[model samples]
Target: MPPGVPLSPPPPSALANPESLTRRSHRFQPKSIWPVAILAMFVMLAIVGIKAYRSLSQNPAQSEQTVEQEARLPVRVTRAETGLAQKWVFDDGIVWPVKRRVLTFQAEGDIQAIAKINGRDLRAGDVVTKGQVLATIDSRRQRSAIDTANADVEVAVQQRNQAQATVVQAQASLDRAKSDLELAKTELVRYQELFDQGVISESDRDVYLNQVDQAEAALRSAEQDVRSAEDGVRSAEAQITAAQARVTETNVDLEDTQLVAPIDGVVAYINIREGEYWDAQRLNSGSDQDLIESAPIILVNPQDIEVEIEIQADEANEIDPGQLTYVVLEEDVSAAQAAGASNQDLLEIAQDNGSRGTVFSVSPTQTPGSRGTQVSIRGFSSAQNLR
Candidate 1:
């Protein structure tokens, strides 16, 4: 120990007194102060977090209430109860003809006349009546043929007359032959009697018998000639009949050279013009080739028109031919006008007033590009006026 340093009391020996050293270290160190400070900080933070969460939760309701107060304003509305038929439906469609006909020619020839012009305005779709000359063909050749046939018929008539005269001559010749045979038989009998009485020579009697045989052969030959003449007359008569029939046929052909309308209708189409060669029964060139054989040369549509619709098979079964129905032309007519009107009103007004129509028809096949059935609505021109 240094002088002047009063040796502090000898330091306690931790090895000898471990418990005393521990107590001294413990007294100098803080035991619970740090734990208490940390706990207080945690409590302060918890309180602050609770207060913030409550304020955030209540803010949305306060903002919503303020907005609702500001939004209270004024508005206006209109009221009208328009009547509508509940049973009606609407479908799209196109207008088409109810009845149509076509015209054509019977014989091959050049067309000389055309009474109806293309695009000609017609009244009531009226058409030319049967036998009405629609066009004429160049009939020079046909006329010549008819003349030839007529001449042949005249010649046949003359020949038939000649045949009849021959038949009469044959009858006369047959009568004469019979008389000659009778006379020869009587002469032969007389000669035989003379020979038996010995009033004539035997050679003379034989000569008389020979004369009788010759006369009989001549009569037989005349009778055969008459029969041949009669056969000739029959043949001439048959020729006359055939000639007459040919004349009749040629006349018919000549008449056919004139093209005529077989029905009465408005000319809807015209395929030929005056001076145009309309070769009948031949395929037309260019655009006219599509004409059907039974088609008329002119197309005439009847006054009546009908609408067709394609509907699904299932829905179509519910419709009957005469079933009553209404149509709503939503796009064509105003809703106000259509409301409260009967189904018949749509049709009647359409016809008389040219109003848009609201009459409908149902069909049996599904409409294209649609999932359900199709229906057609008919409208009169009058109905179109109810726009």
Candidate 2:
């Protein structure tokens, strides 16, 4: 009976608020949320599975890569082969050539000419051969003197020839005089025999005797002429000899005007140039060192370059002729100075600078007043940094 009365109509409030009814309906059916939760759970599981699969897929390669990287250590490698083992000795030294010469003019004059190379005037560092005429002073005066001497010699020679002709003429006259004297004597003797036999008169015999006397006088005169001619010839010969000597002297003077190189070498220094005056007496007046320093030309054999070093006796003992050597450069010297250099450092410096050489000579004994010895290193001049 009550349900039949309630069934009159649904309430307006309940009808107006449909959301409440829906909420009420949802409250009674809680099982509906499980499908969405299950879907979300499945989505999360898929994400987890994808991540796990990716991690599993990359781990083996990464692990292998890491293992490979960790297995190796950084190192350098080189081929094993036989080679020369070098021992280095460190030192500071002075470099010079073994064969050096200082050349100067022997006569005083203005320089008229100088050697040339590559179309340029000869300068320091130019190579030259033995007997090269490096320069020549003005030789006009010497040439003039030589010309005068030659003229004198020619004149003297002519005099000698004239004197020789005169001697020949005198000899011919002497021969004729001898024949005349012999004829006169024979005639005189024949005339005397005739007179003794009373076949000739006294006057004829007397005339023949007189002829003989005259002939003797002529012979004496001819002999004197011959002697005078010989004397004149001798005088002419002496004058010729003296004139020739003068010619020789002038030739030597002319030669003195030129500067010649005595050996094959490079020009180390040149003080004279064309048109400059050179004075032998003045240039040669200074001490040897000064002379060398101021000499007109200086030459050095590049292949015979040498370096002189003063090192401790103990250090020098390790060096000998034919041992390898090297030169420390200025830059290397600075670095060495900063680091208190060792032999190894010096070796590295020399190798980098390319100044390689060999020991040429070592003093046999220590220096007189110190425990040091002198050592010489030989190298080519092309080793630019060797000094």
Query: Best lDDT goes to which candidate?
Result: 2
Q: Write the per-residue lDDT of candidate 2 for residues 1-387, one digit (tens) a residue.
A: 434442233457866998987878856532334557779999999999999988778878797998799879777889887644555445556667789888877799899999988889999989999998999999999999999999999999898899899999999999999999999999999999999999999998999999999999999989999999999899999999999999999999998998889999999888888998888655653444566567899898866677788888877777779877667666666777688976566666767775677878899988776568988877543476753
- Residue-wise C-alpha lDDT for candidate 1, range 121-187, written one tens digit per residue: 2223446675776666778887888888778878877877887787788778778877877887888
Off by more than 4 A, model 2: 1-94, 115-120, 127-133, 200-206, 260-265, 281-293, 307-384
**Ten-residue region with minimum lDDT total, candidate 2:** 1-10
TM-score of each: 0.52, 0.58
RMSD of each: 30.2, 25.4
**Candidate 2 TM-score, true structure as reference:** 0.58
Every candidate's lDDT: 0.62, 0.82
Pairs in clash, predicted candidate 2: none
